[model samples]
Target: MKKMTAMVMALVMAAGMTACGNVNETSSNVGAKIENTAEVQTTDEQTEETQNSEGAEMSGIDGGWIIPDEIDMDKNPEARAAIEKTFVKMMDAEYEPVALLGKQVVAGTNYCILCKVTSLYNHTRQNYAVVYVYEDLEGKAEITDTMDITLGNTENGYAETGAENIEGGWSISDEIALDKHPEASAALEKARETLVGAEYEPVALLGTQAVAGTNYCLLCKVTAVWVEQPTYVLVYVYEDLEGNAEITYTTDFTLGDADEEYSETGEEKMEMPNPWVEYSTAEEAGREAGLAFNVPEKLGEKSIYLIQAFDGLAEVRYGTEDNEISYRKGREVDDISGDHNDYNENSAMEIDDMTIYLRGNDGKVFGAVWNDDEYSYSYYAANGVSMETAQADITALINENK
Candidate 1:
């Protein structure tokens, strides 16, 4: 559940950041000369400017802070001095500037600078420093606030947060109308069938955005069965560039009363026989009923009963206090086509060339029905027990009998 909660938060944050316009913009600091040795390709306009501009200013700021070429030292002397003074104070406390991530002018005289820095004493961890520079009453630029934030503790580090605060590239956009993205509708239907074992119409695309780091991300809302209530659930779908999509996360929130409680349909329930008679083995019970029986070793503390018998078929039941498994076999019941619809096609398993089907609702082993030219056999286990254990036991029974 903690993992589920974290997944929900991630989806929400992904969508939320898109709505807030935090995608990174390449043009924010157009004239800034980045000292980073990492080669980054810029657009044609940037390339033209780089060729025309002369060598940038290389002096003035102490504490080894690299002054961005965009920060015109001659034009904004006051602002340059203020940032240098602040950087020096930071260095005195052992924090050294490592990289100038970005810089942008917010208003008439206010500017924001984002940087990556490291503690000189503790070189292991990295931190983000946001410096806000504003013009004072006398029109002299001064440092207003410097907030240093630690990074890399959470699953999504500065990448997620940076995407949440920056503006422009590959971020979540507005809520995509269902008509605009027709493929999202089909994806929602598939998600409902897989998660709730029922069909549901999606309400809308809650949000759509291409992740800054990942290829694609989408969040949508659909009505689904949560507990016994019909609720709105957020489904997060992720896709690679190749268009392979997977439902990666879901968050449930109650909506209102449902028309009816969700339940598995089509299964016919039978009453327990009044006079329960015990049988030692399948052979003994089948012999009395004039039929052939193949039974495996009794599992757990089970009691075998000759539950019922008719003209061409018989039912033998093995049960513990809370779990029960039934085996029905006969020559005339060779055509089990009528009961085939109740099985989940997606949950098929092949053992010894026999195909077994599970219940669609809860993934429990519904039963296995097969004919061997002479006779037919069907095995089913009650719901609420471990399907894995039941399948294993059923497989053993079938292997031993066949």
Candidate 2:
């Protein structure tokens, strides 16, 4: 009986040990599976992060110019550094960035950035905008081009009120036949009349800008041969609501002249004097002058109130009574030379290969001597006008004859 009891106890102990070993094995397998799953998840996260980083690097640009919200300074370190270097080089000094006009990815890896910058140097403040182009090589940025974008106002060569309306609108091809556009042709004719009280052959329509209203600013080049050098007059036409355009401005920089300012509102309204004499036509005046004077029936936007022509001289009075132009072709007068000698050396300027004496005393005065061998051409302008304005006006008269 004692032997049987001991054997039963031993069998029970063996069964318990087997059960414990099986449980331990199952736990170890489960822990190993969990560890493998965690490793795979961590690897997948790392791969995704690397792909995102590479995508950002390949992205061409990470910032914008005009809208501030588009600029990402943190992620786009390369572009920011490139733009700063370009601005420093172009500006030639440390300049404060004002605002970005815009930016674009021109080609595959080429980018263009437009921004306004201000420079304070020598107590003068200058503000302007510039466009910079960058070429990307691998992951580096290289500057390609830098362009200045600034328009001139009345103080320069362009009109003050209407310049902004026409900028970048349409640049008329120099090759475009002027005769094809009647409106342009008419505008040229109108410009000639308003400019010099005559009609001139239109050389080319440089460009045209249509204003928000019915008005248009026509930039036309007229045929002119004042000096030995080929002379070209830039005529700015301010078209009115009635579709009639007049020369409100003129610029001829080659002659050392600034732009001429005309009526900003439109054509001038003038009343004739009590005793006014009108020629039937300008051709009649030309016939009277012996030399053909290419005079228009009207001077400026208004019709000529008086036309006086004599031997070797012609005068067309238009607009106000004080406003008039006199053309004389004859021997140089002795008194005129004495009057010219009165001007100091500092008051002399050359225009159309002719030396002109300027006077600032009693209104602005300009006197010039032109000799065509067969005839001597002399011109004079008074009443507070700039030297350049006088040159342009007189050059127009000389061009008509040539």
Candidate 3:
């Protein structure tokens, strides 16, 4: 990651969006540049460039960064001593060194250590971060920068599943719909009344986690008071049982070129976090899960896009995040997709000599579950539909002849 890249990009691009939370990607020096002088400077520098004087042409490396043969902390005591001297408790994030990634030699030594970051707010969620520690000729060590290594969800942006997170952690999932969640909408409005400087348009209701109170993570399209081009931010809000809500935190991210790309595609896109589920294709998922599954030519006459995964079990998704057909397949276990939500309607359809049970609200069908002697399977439609549509879709999935 480029240190001070944001500092330079902010001035270059006129940083339309900035946040009050942790700026994780390379914010070392803000106002000063690390010069080429022989002086052993130890403070965070402002320059985006990592300049190496003698090590430039040593290994066909054009970026002025070098990789030494030995980087073990035990082998290189400097690495161990440097972290001990520089590692400090952060406000929102804390880092534990995993290994020395690499190093750069400038006026002082800059070391990049791979670290496991524990969220101070939600201790249950942990992710990787690259920590940059600068050690000077005087043997003084100080942290210069940190870059979080987070991936985005395929449906939304990057993050693990909402089903996996606890309180204080951000669950960047596309499963929760903002339009369907009145509580999140209410909490956002409650917090928005207090936010005076920026305009936030809700993009996605990531999910809700409960600690002492309930925490809601939202993906919002942000525009400063100046109508200064829209940007994206993940806004965290806390709601008490009494319905009192307040903004807890905000972090900015970019998923693609522009915000309209999502609106145009008709997907409830999140900022650049990976889907909570592992992203893989139908064929790849079948290989990983050790089961051969078929894709429908047209599920209920809807030309759906299929993306499936093997996260403990097979999770197959069809259609967009808004109106999806969720299909799950695995060995020897079944319950209303593991959730306690009950549909008012339930029925059974005999297809290909297998009894496919269906469930939904009112007289429509939104859920279906069945099992062979070998495995259990389920299919759910986000928006309820006619029982024939569910049966047709199930037939298309199971019987290639249909």
Cα-based TM-score, every candidate: 0.27, 0.25, 0.32
Summarize candidate 1's per-residue lDDT along 172-261 as a digit string, tens digits.
Answer: 223334566677665544433433222234443533444532222232223222212222333545444554454544433211111121
Which sections of candidate 2 miss by over 4 Å?
1-278, 296-304, 331-346, 357-363
Worst 10 residues of 1 by lDDT: 256-265
Q: What is the Cα-based lDDT of residue 11 in candidate 2? A: 30
Cα distance off (Å), candidate 2, residue 142:
82
Candidate 2 residue-pair clash tally: 1
Task: Rank all candidate structures by their TM-score, best first, as comma-separated numbers.
Answer: 3, 1, 2
lDDT measured at residue 258 in model 3 versus the true structure, 0 to 100: 18
RMSD of 1: 29.2
Tens-digit per-residue lDDT, 188-299, candidate 3: 8986684444567775565566656677767566655332234345566667777777665454532111122221111221222222345446666656656665566456
Clashing pairs in 1: 22-166, 23-167, 23-168
In the range 1-402, model 2's lDDT, one tens digit per residue, is 112223234334434544454211110010011110100000001123323432112111223112223333333454566666442433222333332323444322333333333221111223232333343444444443333323222334344332244544544333334565677777656644523311244543445566642223332222222111221234455565566655444432111110112101011111111212246655666566555656444323535665655443444544556755444443323212112234432365565665554455544654555565555555544343556666666666666666
lDDT of each: 0.40, 0.37, 0.52
Q: What is the lDDT of residue 220 in candidate 2?
A: 29
Which segments of candidate 3 are over 4 A away from where they belong? 1-280, 336-339
